[model samples]
Target: MDPGSKLPLSPHIQIYRLPLTALLSVVHRATGVALALGAVLLVWILALAANSAEAYGQLYPHLASWYGQIFLLGLIFSLYLHFCNGIRHLFWDIGMGFDLEIVHRTAKFAIFAAIVLTVATWAIAANLEL
Candidate 1:
């Protein structure tokens, strides 16, 4: 190795394309973070509810707003995605679904199932009144 030679660099982001499993792994970590933030928000809401009915009343409208509904939907999707991927990981831990084809198939299935579950959840929630 020449001391004056430039070090080799990894491929640029624009040139690198992640496979489905790799992308799912990244999404899993992101959703984990999102879920943590959602937990904090949940705690704050619970605290408000416990404090006074007035405080809860003040917060309810905003939460029921269109933008708030969108944020909640994203949170719900994140939860399902994280959950489905976690189960996939559990299966892998148990010495199953190790083949490359099986791995990709499960990754796709987990995503598809998560989407369906998220939609079903929101649909059911939309029908119930407080």
Candidate 2:
């Protein structure tokens, strides 16, 4: 190796294409933050539920709005994704899902399963007569 030779630096994002795994990694962290915030929101809902009917009534209207619905939907999606990916991590802890092909396939499957579960949960919630 020539001590005076200049090493070529890697191309920047402007010249690079992000891969699925890279995107998923970023989404995982973002969803984790979302889930933490959702947990606080859930605690607020529980507090409302435990209070008197009049107090609960006051909070219910806000939650019935379209914006609230969207936030709830996003929380549900984040919860499912986090849960599914957590289980996948458990498998990895046991020394599985390390193979390149298996890792990609399982990650894809987990994402799909999370989406399906989130949709199913929302559908059931929508159908509830409450």
- TM-scores, one per candidate: 0.89, 0.84
lDDT of 1 by residue, 31-119 (tens): 99999999999999999999999999998998899999999999999999999999999999999999999999999999999999999
lDDT of each: 0.95, 0.84
Error of 1 at 87 (Å): 0.3
Q: Poorest 10 consecutive residues of model 1 by lDDT?
A: 7-16
For candidate 1, the per-residue lDDT at 52 reads 100
**True lDDT of residue 108, candidate 2:** 92
Position 66, candidate 1: lDDT = 96
Q: Indicate the TM-score of model 2.
A: 0.84
lDDT of 2 by residue, 1-130 (tens): 6778798556677877776666677778899999888889888888988987888889887778999888788889888988888888899899988888887888898899999999999889888955
Clashing pairs in 1: none
Best by TM-score: 1
* Over 4 Å off, model 2: 1-8
